[model samples]
Target: MRILVILRQVYEQKSIQWSYEDRKLIYQRNSYNKSDLHALQWTREYKLKADALVDVLILKKEEEASEENKLANFGIQRCFRIPSNGSEKEDAAFISDLLKNESYSLILSGYETEDEHSCALLPLLSYELGIGVLTAVYQLEGKPNGQLTALRKEERGSLQEFTIQLPAAVSVTSHISKLRYHRGRSAPDFTMIEVKRQLSKPEAVRRIEAPEPNIWYADTPSEEIPQLRLLNIMGFASQSNNSNNLQKQTDHLSKAHLYFTAERLVKWLKE
Candidate 1:
């Protein structure tokens, strides 16, 4: 029973940014920031992670001739070099070809690639391979006939243990378990070889042109109004020279009070 683990070198999260141009999320320039993690460290950490699984082997995507030998030192048993045009679809097709000649009991890949491609290959590979795909598997219990039970995570922090049959392909999520470290006895000789990749030229689906921006600015000042000011106690009063007449009017109003006539009260009583 042979297990093949697919490893890829991807850019850090910060080094890439998503832009919503058109209807899809397109990767744009890193006007954002840089990431600290590198592929070497990531692969080294996985050495510990791969150790936890039952009856499984780890491998790198063979690049040059010496890649597999170099990876062997890091405890990788076999390596698969995909073509340069290796999209997820191509990767699935390549795996299918392997299933025809070589016997691989199971294929394992990360739940998502470190780059923009995430979960794109899993379902396709599973469909093509025609086997049960157990994704995000954290723990595994190996059986005699290559059948195993894996504890996989569902939505909302839930777990479901799946009893998977042999000849399966899976995408593992990091949320499933704590990654382990690698402690190997010796490093294997790194050899270099060119593995033929299965890929074709991608078609130009759409052409995009940056639209002109609609930016405008205005320079305007707030309008100010003049306010009236108080002059003096009586200087700003009306220019009426008849002070005696004004006093007479004021005195009449001051002395005027409410006078309820008896005739009005009699009218009210009649009503």
Candidate 2:
């Protein structure tokens, strides 16, 4: 069975900040961070399990071609590169065309990509390919007749296994396997290809910038009114302050407090 594994090089968490303005995604580099751990681990898992052969595909920005190829010496003997168009939707279309042209039994992808394009592609691939998508698969066992069994995390803190039919797409989590130091026999053959983006490029979700109409902020010190502070809701006040005569009686009554009130009502009724 042939497997097509989709991978990507990612900036470490908090390495880049994303902002949007006028249909553009504004990228602000905070620091040079590493790739996503989950993405790396997923790639490493296939390196060990892929017995017959595995084809890897990496979606990377043009500028990051060098940095993203750090995995070349690893399990990837060669990879099909899909130049990113900065649009997840457009990227998925190119990927779908590639998968459809090729005959692959199963398609694998990381649960989340560097910029979360996998969020758009994973499901889109399943729909476009007319297959089922089992996400977060950590372990898998394939059976004859195009049936495969996969293990994934359950919502209740347990592992759940699924039997998915073949011709399926999956988005896997890091729990699948641990990353290794072993590299493939040779440097991976990397091929870059151009994609003609057909869809409108993915626009930034929403832009954040200096306010033209207004700016909404919470707890701004510049505002004249000090923010209200909540305190002592848990009855943390001084014991002396709570030690009034009525308070003392209420505490002493305990279970008898309701009985005292009932008796007073009965007395008033009789009168």
Q: Model 2: which residue pairs collide?
A: none
Give a tens-digit lDDT track for model 1, residues 20-89. 5664335532210011112222334544544322122222233422223334444444444454343667
lDDT of 2 by residue, 175-201 (tens): 665655445444445554444434455
The reply for model 1, stretches above 4 Å from the true place, is 16-74, 180-193, 203-271
Model 1 TM: 0.52
Q: What's the lDDT for candidate 1?
A: 0.50
Tell me, what's the RMSD of every candidate?
21.7, 10.7
Candidate 2 lDDT: 0.60
The lDDT of each candidate is: 0.50, 0.60
For model 2 the TM-score comes to 0.61
TM-score for each prediction?
A: 0.52, 0.61
Cα RMSD, model 1: 21.7
